[model samples]
Target: MVALKEALARNGGLWIGCAPEQREAPSNELVMHQRPDFDIGLFELEPPLYRDFYLGYSNSVLWPALHGRVDLIDVKPRYAKAYRDVGRRLARLVAGAVNDDDVIWVHDYQMIPLAHELKALGVKCRIGFFLHIPMPDLQTFKAIPEWQDLARCLSDYDLLGFQTRRDLSHMINIFRNTLRGELRANGTMGISGREVALGSFPISIDVAGFRELAASGADKVSPPPLPRLIGVDRLDYSKGLPQRLAGYEAFLETHPQYRSRVSLLQIAPPTRDDVDAYKAIRSELESLSGHINGRFGTVDWTPVQYIHRALPRTELAVLYRLSRVGLVTPLFDGMNLVAKEFVAAQDERDPGVLVLSQFAGAAEEMPEALIINPHDPHDIAQAIKTALDMPLSERMKRHSALYAHLESHNVTRWSTAFLKQLTSVERIGPDGVAPLPGSTPWSRTA
Candidate 1:
């Protein structure tokens, strides 16, 4: 939301959001709210449609499949129907509101069918879709119900964007191999009798803004008494919170000297409390945290601090600055901004080490950091030790390189690059289908 708002603030555009839940069905009109630079259009959906679409199909099915947890998928015939219904309704609202020349950019998995629905409604402006989550491997993605239907909807877009080269490849391969679609001589995919453009535009943080926030908050918040290993994420299965806690436990058991001297603080704000999978993960985390503390914690010294609520971003920046290690080990992630934010919120002279997961999208850009397999507790434990024992000079060198890369590929640059590519795709005419710029024979990246 912040990234989109920032982009629209600079180049004014409309933002659409669903309004607060209401007992009665809302009128077809879209509620309007004016911002300084852009306008927000709010609409309301009937309760059942909202629930089945947002929580049922989007979160229950697509979320699990995208995160590579096929076992967790909850598919119902009604869920898919409601998902399409919501898409069709939103398309009608948008079709009536926007002009034919306006560019429409749909975001995330929830609205994958938006472009197809809009096209059906004869809304001819160019449409682009960007997935903010990982595109699972072919087998895992195929596990989702109505997988082919989703793929067809995706191919209707003028351009499709992903967060990493790996994700882009997974998607294109799915289209070609599974859908039996052909790759054109020129780089576009010939699917459903139309061509589609694809690219990987890795998203990024507002580096300078985050750095200043950390610096400003440093004096307001007190530093930890002992060396602190901080992990901040939403309480979700994909975050690997249980694995992280188990790793911390292994660290304490393997190195008894630091048992009471060091601490691991995990801040996981709750999300999707209504989902069974989310509830299960929360219960597991609570049990794991309790077990770790009971095993190693003392009356005076706590080994693990588990926080279930969120902290203000300013305060989080302060905590990041004071921590000795920033441990981000997600099972799978599109682009974990917390890892980048931790790097941004550091004291460069005696900077904290970032022990990141190899599976995280951020790891592709930040190779200087200590990367470990998130699935292995022993690997995470050893990586933590290495990060803590690293020399000050080495820490400074790694931090410098990481910070430099962040500055070069900051969020502003990320948004600008994506918009530029979308514009180029639009110029290819009404269909907005052309060979991706700088296309390779089999693979492509932007």
Candidate 2:
């Protein structure tokens, strides 16, 4: 929504399709709802279709699959029917709202099938679809009962975007091998006379906004009594929260001298509480934190401060600035924005080190980060020690490189680059499809 709002503000004449309930409410970035003469239209769908098709099937089935949790994918005949029905309904809504020249950008796996439905309805607008999560490998993808149908449905889009080259490659490989679709060298797939361009376009944070927040003295609201280590993440199974707690405990055990002087603050906002796996992971994290604090607590100080609630952006920025080290260890993430936010909030005179996970997509771009394997508690512990103990010269060099990269490629740059490429694809019709325009073939090693 943030990206769309920014894009629309720069270039108006956009009509968004959202749930009828949100029609009257204005978005935080744009006052489109308050604009009584706005062309935006909200449509209604049956409650069962919204709940079962979108929330149930799309999130429960496709979400886990894309995130590499093949075990959690549950497919029923009714769910597939519900998915198709909702897709058709959304197609009608989009068709009604769009014109031939309008560029339709669809977000995430929730509306994968909608592109095909839109094409079927003769909506000739250039459709772009961006998948926000990891695309599972072929083996895991094939495990889904309707994988072939899903792949076919996705090919209807003019351009398809993924958070990383690995994700885009995985999708291309699946279509070519599993679905037997023809793949062009440029990552375009041909399925039943339709061509879709596949590309990697990682999402980014609002660098200027965060920098302004940090510069405006909003990041130093209340200084901590002592130097602090912080970890901010959504409470999810993929975040490796238990491992992070274990690592902090290991750090405490390894460096007993710093125990009383340094403390760790973990701010995890709970999400997907309805899912059994998510609930189980949250319980395990709580148990692990309690065990560590019970064993390591002193008369006046606790080794770990765990808060399982959401903090406002300003407060989080303040916490980021106060902390001496930003610990971001996700087991698997498309792109962790919190890592970038932490870097942007730093005071250049005394910037904090970022302990990032190698598995996170952000690590591919921010190589200066102290990358570690989240599965190894010892590695994480040592990284923490190294980050805290590093000399000023070394810290400045790493921070400089990371900060420059982040500033150069802010959210505006990311959105503009993606939409520009998508628009270029639209200008050149399906017949103009070629191998990726300018870059070398994307490789995992690269």
RMSD of each: 5.0, 6.4
TM of each candidate vs. truth? 0.94, 0.88
lDDT of 1 by residue, 1-446 (tens): 67777787878899998887754668788889897899999888888888888899999999999999999999888888888887888999999988878888899999998887787778878788999999988888899867767777787788899989889889988987655667766657776456678888888878899999999889777788899999999999999899999898889889898888888889999999999999999999999999998888889988889999999998899899999999999999998999999999998988999999998988989999999998899999999999999999999999999999999998888788878877776233445433222222112110
Which consecutive 10 residues in model 2 have the weakest lDDT in total?
A: 437-446
- Model 2 C-alpha lDDT versus the unseen true structure: 0.78
**lDDT of candidates 1 onward, in order:** 0.86, 0.78
In model 1, which regions exceed 4 Å deviation? 184-187, 426-446
lDDT of 2 by residue, 93-202 (tens): 66876788888888888788887777777787788888877887899888767776677667667888988888888888887875567887766776545567888888
User: TM-score of predicted model 1?
Assistant: 0.94
